[model samples]
Target: MHRVLLWIKQDLRLDDHPALQAALDADRLLPVYVFDPELLQPGPLGCRRLGVHRARLLLESLAALDGELRQRGSALLVLQGSAERLIPSLAERLDMDEVLTLDEVAPEERAQLDAVRQRLGDIRLLLAPGNFLLRDDELPCPVDQLPTAFGPFRQLVEQRLPVFQPRPAPARLPALPDNAGAYFASLPSLSQLGLGEPLSVANSAFPFSGGEPAAQARLRDYLWLSQGVRQHQQTRNGMIGSEYSSKLSPWLASGCLSPRRVLAELRRHEAQYGRNDSTQALWQELLWRDFFRWTLLRHGGALFRAGGLKATARAPRQLDRRFQRWCQGRTGVPLVDANMRELAITGFMSNRGRQVVASYLVGELQQDWRHGAAWFEEHLLDYDPASNWGNWAYLAGIASDPRQRRLFNVLRQARQYDPDAAYVSLWLPELHGVPQHLRHTPFLLPHLQLDALGYPRLESIPENWRPYLPSAA
Candidate 1:
């Protein structure tokens, strides 16, 4: 009998899963997920890699995966420890012929895979392509030779769009060995992981649960039911409500949803409704996601460095009370504070809000961008290493295109995106009594009124903000 130990990583779903498909060939298959305790500990940036929000989603995803596996005559074995040591030891004890898993691009994850490989000595360790939209062979050029900038890369890929044919979930997974029950362990709760349960926010943008079922349901709702994606380009920058965007990132990041699967459904939607700017916008986003992953593969640990791909770039490196204030949503800048507070409470923030706040931290506050990135790593339910670090570096002016530092004018962005200040009022209850016109510029309010509202006073206003401030303020 060909006994195979299937190790699950980021790709939690069985649908369109490459590693799970390869493992199906085994006569006796034991699928497992190794929950690394290190993720609960603080990293170099002094933030735990896995925070409450992500930990809760991860546990839910694991439970969902186990349910799906059990239906196919197998079950997921979640073990708490280092993958390198646990995987090898388990494989040797089980006398598995081989250990199989999906490959990864991030440096730390790659290192873990190597360590596991070394420990597996005589046993074969097979690696399948990771959970990404495009395969290496399908890339327009070698990853090393890919374009340095997103635009050029998008243009190059658009010239020859590869066809995506995602695999269906297997109807039957092989049964586990008779002794597998001894190794099975229960899933850990958020408290067990040393994280308090996050309070539910009625205004959460991503209110959906994590798993393949939820991911597929969302795809159907956005494309067929509500047809909200038809207006994606117009409403993508919206900061309020779940209808504003697809809200698929959390599942996408957790690998509960396959990028290829998303693309396939998107293509079908376009065929029936006819292509439009909105559909094209989502296509572009998937490409951007692919671009960042390729960039991470090419640059390795450099992507996470102080200078990113551009080592000589003059990136800010400072942290103080300003950083702490920014994190707690008390930056005294209404727009920045609202977005930060939303993220802290709901574990979700709009794309426009992210850029505006990140710009405020780097450009206005002049703090170290990595700290902000690390903070996102901890709180964001949709945090992906490549996209999170890459975008932060780009906005901080340390990534490939240093010339494109996303030093946005926060006041201008506030006026344009939150013109009515509804987003601001929703997140900042203290600003509710302020007039709509002056809500975003509370610093201009009289000393007594500002103090009464309990809002922090802006120490200094930028010259660019003068034009955007309300006349009444």
Candidate 2:
């Protein structure tokens, strides 16, 4: 009997899991999850590589995966250490026939795989696809031929591409070898992982916990139960409420859910209810997610570089208190401040809000773009390395797109998007009493009036802007 070790990474779910299925093909399967200390350690920016919101979500996912494995007569073995060393040592000690896991593309993640391979002594390493909607070989064109500009990429994908039908979960996994449960410790809690309990942000857009079961259930609730997908495109940009979007990104980011599974469900929805623009729009966003993933393949580690893929270097600005205020949501700009506050508290932000905040950070503040990207990496629940950094690169005008740098007019955006101050007030309650008319720019009022409203003054005000104020001196 060939005994193999299944080393799971971001691809966390069991259903539609090609890697997990391959492990079952062997005579014996030992599933293990190692909590790497390097990832949990604080980075130079003083934020853990994984923040509390995402850390808690990952723990939930592991628990759910383990529960499902137990029902199948197998269990996930949880260990804590450097995976590069621990995995090789485990494979050697157990005399495993092979190690099966998901393939990684990012430089840091790929490094771990390389280290394991060097230590495995010719052990077979079967790496499957990451959690992408379409695998590399399945692409309509060679990945290198895939366009960097989203328009061309989307055109090519929609014109000629196939989304693989997801495979069903196994009815029953083969039992582990005798005494496999004793091999490692149980899954760690939020506290055990050196993190505290999750911060309960009031009115968080994504209040759902993590795991495959939750991921599956959310798909049902959003589409079938509530018919939310029918209006997803319309309300997706709204910042105030949870009903606006599908909110499946957190699951998608962690690999608790597969993009193929989502695609299959969207197809079924169209078949049952007939086709519509809303359904098509949702499908397009998934393709955008695919576009970012492909960008990583095209550019490699350049995605992490300060200048992104553009060969030309950008001039730097002072990244001192101003940058820190932007991160902390203390920026004097009302819309920018509210969005930043939302992200800092909730680990989530709307698509529209993301664009506005990104524009404010890089275009208006003139700060280094990578710093904002890193802060999002530290805080966002649905943070995808490619999407987060890729979007930043695009916003900074250094990405593959031929477009020039774009800047959002924040005050105008606040009026158009939050005309009644509904979204703003929800996240920034201190400004709730600042009247609907003055909500967008509370500082425009006289100093006495601003103080009377109990709202804190913005960190800075533009000199020219004060001349037009209602009671400016």
Candidate 3:
């Protein structure tokens, strides 16, 4: 009988799993997951995104996956080490003939795959798609030819393209070796991984448990019980509450969910409840997600550079004291400060807050955009490398935007979105007593009032505060 190994990376779920199906096609399957040390190392922000909460959820998900596999007479093997070393070593030890895994576009992940291929001599590598509905090569335009503006990209893809349907989950898995259970041990705990205890639900946007089962339940509730899928575009930018958005980013980031599954369910909702503008809006956002993935696939290592995917000569700017103040949430801008504080504590921020904080960093403070991007990588539970880097480059005027230096009018945005000061009050308690009109710009209040509120005074605005305009010929 042929022995096969399935190397699980970000594609963590059983449903719609092409790699897992390929493994089962063999006579026997050895499912393994390696915890790479490189990923656990602290990023430039001095914090690992795999914090206590994510670690705990990962352990729980692994346990569930093992149990499900056991029901089918198989068990998952968990190993703690670098994938480059561990995966090939296991393949040799088990005498496996082939290795199957979902394809990844990120540079770092691709490097890991390359290392594995080099170590294992002439081993068959089966690549499958689970990340996006459209393949990278299948995009209508090449990376260089693609539009630099989001609107044009959205228009072209949404109007002309079609999304692929998701594959069904396997009814049963292949049996494992007789000694598989004895070799497999318990998953590492949060504390065991040198992280803190599980995060309390009070602070998280997604308080639900992790794993594919939980993801499917959320999809059901969001579509059926709440019927919020129909109104997603209308309420998605909300900051005060959880129900406003789908809150599927965490699941999506961890690979517990697939975008195809989400699209399929969304179509079902549209069919049953009748299509509307809101449904189209949600589809647009999902397309944005796909667009970012395609961007990374096309550009590869260029996404991490200062001038992302663009042929421009730009020098890295010197870091200013004002930039540090923004990072610490002491910019004296209540809306921006509150959003930054929320991200620091909860590791989650609304999309509106993300854009605002990113704009404040790159546009207002004139700081190195990479610093803010690194911070998001360390803190955000839903952090996708492509989206995070792509967004920062866009804000920094280095990536996609044809007209560089997109500056957000913080005050105008505050008046439009947080007019009632609800979101501001939730994060900045000092501004709780401030009136709705002045909540966005508390520095405008009188000196004695500001002193009474315990808010700090703002210094001179930076030179970059002016609206960005294209250079004249």
Candidate 4:
């Protein structure tokens, strides 16, 4: 090929970029990132589809990407418009022989790709795999035949599939065509994008900035330097601090770090410092991530349905006003409130916290699971379409091991995971300086004391649970 256009998406980094490598198979390359406003539009029932936190992270990642490309005598063209029109039009204007990009699995993503392809008519467009640890074509069987259970999928992939070595970034790139720089649209600022300046949450667990250097640095600290990976299984459930977990999800979701590279590095870490159950547990998470990718591929639009894989199943509970309390973290559940408030303020949350709140929404509040999923899609910093929606469906008992225990005992979870009440206190300031056990059930406090404590009592308590109040204890 003589010339090509590299359509960068979630895989924003230069290193280990398969699409970029294939584009460089030609003599000239033009890299472009389009800010499709469609992504930011409201989703079902007026739920926000994209939140400011994810948007800010994307901007930072892109700025870093463009800087790296510039150092290599190339640049990332920033455009704000419909990608379906922009990509095909730009390819024709630049006279590129081919357009290259990652093949997305989700329907919305595929729709965009299809639109661009339809517009390209007769132009060569190539799709490559950049995000998953094992690409779709590399799977042992086709997507349709993928195992329904995560355990089966993980076992089969681990035993049979090979995670190929990631392609290294090209040392140099052919510069843009003459005067092609003139086509560069000015990059939008945070304010222009409707996001406020990034600020520190009072006590966030994931505080890292966006970009490749940050991602690599974090990986090194978490796995190699600090050996956090060794203790991952033991501490990943903790809800308070950054070091409790790897904190790599934000970077992984944004594609600053390649999934294949993460898996490869894990293997290298095990090689250097003998393998253990903890490292295996970490590897299992990577498999789960890949499994969700396959889930999206196999099910396509079905995953978005209320019943998910079980389309014939009964409709999920509606998002009632009581569910509104769950969304605001004020459903008289200390643990749920803390986690929800943390997510609202910091744009992050612990995995254990996620499972707990998700279960609460579905099992206790009887809210439709899709509404909660949409909220996560809007607010989570590390939100990936497959993982966010798939997990939500799983928790709501709509997919992925629905027979498993569906409801979370939020009080039990609070005492078990955060006995000190330290995590709760940080997010729910009304309970700050309160006793550890007292924070868990403030509603049980006497009305006068509840007022003194500055916490609101939940009026919608179930009748049978009244005697189990804090005062009785």
Q: Best-fitting candidate, measured by TM-score?
A: 1
Error of 2 at 143 (Å): 1.9
Score candidate 1 by lDDT.
0.89
Return the clash pairs for model 2, or none: none
**lDDT of each model, Cα atoms only?**
0.89, 0.81, 0.75, 0.82
Residues 42-76 of candidate 3 have per-residue lDDT tens digits of: 87555575655566567767777777677777778
lDDT of 4 by residue, 17-64 (tens): 888877775778889898877677787646677688888888889989
How many angstroms is residue 233 displaced in model 1 relative to the true structure, after the best TM-score fit? 0.7
The TM-score measured for candidate 1 stands at: 0.97
Count of clashes in candidate 4: 0
Error of 4 at 462 (Å): 5.6
How much does each candidate deviate from the true structure in C-alpha RMSD?
1.5, 2.7, 4.7, 2.3
TM agreement with the true structure for every prediction: 0.97, 0.93, 0.89, 0.95
Which segments of model 2 are wrong by more than 4 Å?
Answer: 315-317, 398-405, 448-456, 459-473
Q: Which numbered prediction scores highest in lDDT against the true structure?
A: 1
How would you encode candidate 1's per-residue C-alpha lDDT over 67-181 as one tens digit per residue? 9999989999999999999999999999999999999988999999999999999999999999789899998988889998899998898899887889999999999998889
- What is the alpha-carbon RMSD of candidate 1 to the true structure? 1.5
Candidate 1 local Cα displacement, residue 359, angstroms: 0.7
Residue by residue across 1-473, what tens digits does model 2's lDDT show?
A: 88899998887789899888887777778888888767777687656678888888888899999999989888888888889888888888777889999987677788888889888887877898887888877787888888768898888777866746799889888768664656867677888767778777658888887899999999999879999999887887788877888888999999988889898999998999977888998998898898898887678788877765663246243477778988877775778888888887878999999999987887677787778888899889999988988888877764223355446777767777887878777766777777677777887667888777666677566554443343423
